[model samples]
Target: MAGSAQPSRAQLGSDQSASFRPYVAADQSPAEFTAKAVVIGALFGLLFGASTVYLGLRAGLTVSASIPIAVLAISVLKRLGGSTILENNIVQTIGSAGESVAGGVVFTVPALIFLTPYGPEYFRYFQILMLAAAGGLLGVLMMVPLRRALIVKEHGVLPYPEGAACADVLIAGERGGGLAATVFRGLAVGALWKSLSWILQLFRTAVGYSMARTSFFPNATVDLDISPEYMGVGYVIGPRIAGVMVAGGVLSWMVFLPLLTILGSHMSDPLPPVPASGLRIDQMSAQQIWSAYIRYIGAGAVLAAGIITLVRTLPTI
Candidate 1:
């Protein structure tokens, strides 16, 4: 760390005309598209796609497989005795399609059956294949226009985190080795912590308590979760957005619970949903009110906010 030859963060992305620049240079000819590259890329794509399905089902999330796939491509190709940086780039580009398509279909296609009257039978093999195919095609077609503006023009300025990180991985791989190890280190630490928490049962992943038990404030819920991934995400997004999200949770548990109790306890008759014979608001638990009513409202509010943001950004896009 003391006498490192590596360029510091401050020096990156400053030179527009240099070979390090993202765009094509006059002196450099493009890498030939090779058959071997295509075959290898397809295999990695299939592998990542299958793994993504399992991950999405288990964790309800999937990471960008490009960096890891690139690292794997580099390692695998070098051993086969026919490899180049360009081939690695090609492999990553093609393989990345798998995870991207998987995310879109896994999240939406299955939900369509439930959202509609169509049963499981409606979502047959052909239907699923078509859905994924169309979605992938549409994504590619949309990106054709966006690539020049968003990717090239705004290369370093845009701050698209995933794209930037992938670039870093590829560049590091080309330079030598250490950068790829960082990805593995992260994977190891995450697996270790999760194993300690769940396997050993050392501590609850999330510890929560109602403020009514100890504090002057009634019905307030506090939760502390030892989730590095979530906390790191919060920091990356910055304070304002994270604070707004935390405030929403506080409002739901603290303000809404108490307010509902005050308003509903004194009701002359039970609300429409709550039968006359059933328990009143004062009788119901805070969790019941949240589950039955508040959650719907919260969902609608979020949907509205997303729509507003999209509308506001439409002109820029």
Candidate 2:
């Protein structure tokens, strides 16, 4: 039994050593690395940044689908015989910038318009851009300390599904596969859809509807239909998470909205009007309270989920 355990331990050690082997290692001067970084960064930055803007405009949803796209881009590049570590890292960093910015801008910058002297309508020009760039810098800084904890030490523990996908794309690129074309096609379709939607006013940002003001074409609501942005989201999220998102949407739209309207109608006599839009607790209802305050329960659940993941990964680190 002792002899058998020795072989098992030795095999485990060998497997880890093999897994740690670097693929597409680049031995180069600092200057060369810098140059490569700049070139790769610029390329991926444009690729992902453009993608973010397009998706944002199309769906009015700030999506982080760029991570997978970056990975796919790197994979295609690798398959084309240029699978370099420096290049791929540069791509990851650059591509990640757009997502980082989009996340921050979507969450924070919109609040600025409302909080500032001008309402969100005033930020139609460059608020999003400014916030996005600033968010990019913040993301870079935030992820720096995480490098050791996430990339180097954790290894396979955290999954880093995005990173792994990018690595695979890079590898595939080295082999001259069709991923490059597929990615480019996705980008083109996404961009065209966004541009056309904006021009055609497919959705309206009017005060009453919360941005889903498209005409009910052929007896169907536009929001319920899949668009380029939704397709991109589905691609990056895969099937399970996509299902979760769709479920959430259905719950919010079909269940919550209906329930709120019914409750509001029934309680209309007792309480004052809910008002067009203001932060008055007196005019709100149990449903409104649940939607506004109790929704934090869901936020806490999400936060707890993230914390639990981090905690589980701590042992691996």
Best by TM-score: 1
Q: What is candidate 1's CA lDDT for residue 150? A: 61
Total clashing pairs in model 1: 0
Please provide, for model 2 over 1-317, each residue's C-alpha lDDT reduced to its tens digit, 9 standing for 90 to 100: 55564445335544554588666444543222455455656666666666666565454445554445555546644555554545655666666665556555554454454345566666765766675667667767977898765566556445677667766665655455565566677779877776666677676433222212122211111145546667767776689977876776555544554454445445524323333354344355434544454344445555687789999867555
- Cα lDDT of all candidates, in order? 0.69, 0.56
Span of ten consecutive residues with least summed lDDT in model 2: 213-222
lDDT of 1 by residue, 58-173 (tens): 43446678878888777666667746667778888888897788877776665565444555769998988898899989999999999876655544555787766766766666
CA displacement after TM-score superposition, residue 191 of candidate 1 (Å) = 0.8
TM-score of 1: 0.65
lDDT of 1 at 122: 94
Give candidate 1 misplaced runs (Cα > 4 Å): 1-83, 94-133, 148-165, 211-218, 235-240, 268-283
